[model samples]
Target: MLFLVLLGFPVFILCYMLAAPVFGYLGDRYNRKIILGAGIFFWSGVTLSSSFISELYYWIFFLSRGLVGIGTASYSTIAPTIIADLFEEGKRTTMLSVFYIFIPVGSGLGYVLAAGMAGLTGDWHWAFRVSYSLSPMGLSHSLWSFVWSSLGLTAMAFVTGALGMWVPLFLYRAQLAQGTVSPCLQETCNSSNSLIFGGITVGTGMLGVIAGAEAARRLRKINNKADPLICATSMFISALCLYVALMVILIAFGELFLSVNWAVVTDILLYVVTPRRQSTAIALQILVSHLLGDAGSPYLIGITKNDCSPQWSFRSMQYSFVVCAFVGVFGGAFFLLTSLYIEEDRKEAEQTSPSSLNTSSSSLKEAIFRV
Candidate 1:
């Protein structure tokens, strides 16, 4: 059971990685709405079908999850391009933030809904029925959500994938190191800590999104070139926060609270890419980031942990945290580099827009304000 549960996400992500580029290419040349709608319908049907399968059959369940991933790839790859096409610059940042706010919210809701349905029906399979029913409603709405969030998603995946994956165990070991061994030993204590962690993560996550958007909006008002600047600054701060959180465990929550804002910073960066190639660019970004970032973090961290001497078992995971901290810094530096090119690229994109040809001005002043 444990192995199957662990196997599910990576298989899903693997399928997602494989399918994203293909779907993204199609989305760029065809009707995105149709692609997105088909994706939702296919995934919903697959998930609904899964509920009928026996829980004892792990391989079939894994295959179903992979199909879900392929179905989702269609929606995830192209949705943000749609959003980018609908809005401009600062407004795009704000809209993207609003759309991404649902990620953590929906994640939290998934936990609650699953738990509630499991309790009511006394079987986990019934939970899929509820998800299948609700998913169709998402199909009815515009499929523009989350891909712009991919920038932040990549960064968070790097950091959280390395550190957050082991947080509970880290906490347990930390307590053992402090000679206070009972903290994680109690089921209630563990559950309470899990709840607190989830609550803080979701709450701070939404706040970060809102705060980052507003900060970007205000900075843009002061200077047209502030978008990437804001992202660079936020990512730098996030790196610092991760370092502090790792070094001083007592302040870990406070640091995590600050680090959540990095999501907003990275999200706005996606909008800075060329608009015509947005889907392809996004698909590439997704591919590289996940491939280089979270996909290997867990395995890397596990190897690091095993390489340590048995006497240093408690500290093995802390070494992984240090790697995550440095990665956060690298991500920040990448954003700073992006800041250097964004303004010029943005101007070039605006000039190439169909609306630009209809107007008479060669200056960006006219192009920037076009609807």
Candidate 2:
């Protein structure tokens, strides 16, 4: 059943990855705000309607997830381009940090709200429905930005996907193994793990985003290579943090480092890819990242755990989690590779941007290097 639930995420990602190119092409040629707005509506409606589904037709829920992906496609493909157009240099990076911070923040909040409401009401469906009551709402790249950054992000996604799906369960199992908690025999087990996990996610995510943006802004003054380097360093440290599974403090630090990549990576995309092609670049980045990244992470972790299981499921899961650490190292390496090309890509992007008219390539390169 956990495996089945995990499958929907990859399915949604696959749909999201595949649909992004279409939206990318459209966004480049059309009005992006309109497309973004339309997508939000489509996404919201589908999500809201899915809450009403009955267990007899649970499969339809998966289909709705796929539809949700299409809606996500438009926003993912185009929204960053809007930001890129609006801001420049350090300002752009800061704005983007604010933008991408919402990814984990939303996830963290969703987990808290859904779990709290469900626990209080004793109906899981109400968890999904609470969003309607609460109201509110609301990649890719040039080759260097797309290729290296996406490679890095893919690993981040992989680790995030596995951890996101399994951490609560893993925590529960750990306590059980220690004889600190009893095994849950109820159909629905009430536990504080989700609440604690959600709080950690929100806190770590918020702090990480703020710290990363400030670090990048300061570092960029001296180094043309700061963004990718920051990403590389964060990925490496995150790998270390993730390897120490039993320490929740280490896990929090791991999440902090992981969150650092969100904005930095997007900022990398904006500077390396031209605005005209940004939508497509963003789309392609999403495609490659999700295709290779979170799309299969949770499912792969699940199967690996299942295969390794003997008497203790927790031990097997711990073994499966080791994979995430290695992947994080590879992600860091990809960013190092990115540093090789970022300076050249930034100049090229500047030359081709809409505002580059009448500017010489030499002048553009000079301005980029000065930054």
Best by lDDT: 2
Model 2: per-residue Cα lDDT at residue 44 = 78
Top candidate by TM-score: 2
For each candidate, what TM-score against the reference? 0.79, 0.90
Ten residues in sequence with the least summed lDDT for candidate 1:
138-147
Q: Write the per-residue lDDT of candidate 1 for residues 287-360, one digit (tens) a residue.
A: 76677677777667656454444336657777767776676666656656655555565565555554665464
Residue ranges of candidate 1 with Cα displaced over 4 Å: 51-55, 108-154, 176-192, 250-271, 304-312, 358-371
**Candidate 2: C-alpha lDDT:** 0.79
TM-score result, candidate 2:
0.90
Per-residue accuracy of model 2 over 57-162 as CA lDDT, tens digit each: 8689889889989998988788888988888776888888888888788778877887787779866667657765554450213466558777888898888888
Q: Model 1 scores what on Cα lDDT?
A: 0.64
Q: Candidate 2: misplaced stretches above 4 Å?
A: 1-4, 133-142, 185-191, 246-250, 304-311, 360-371
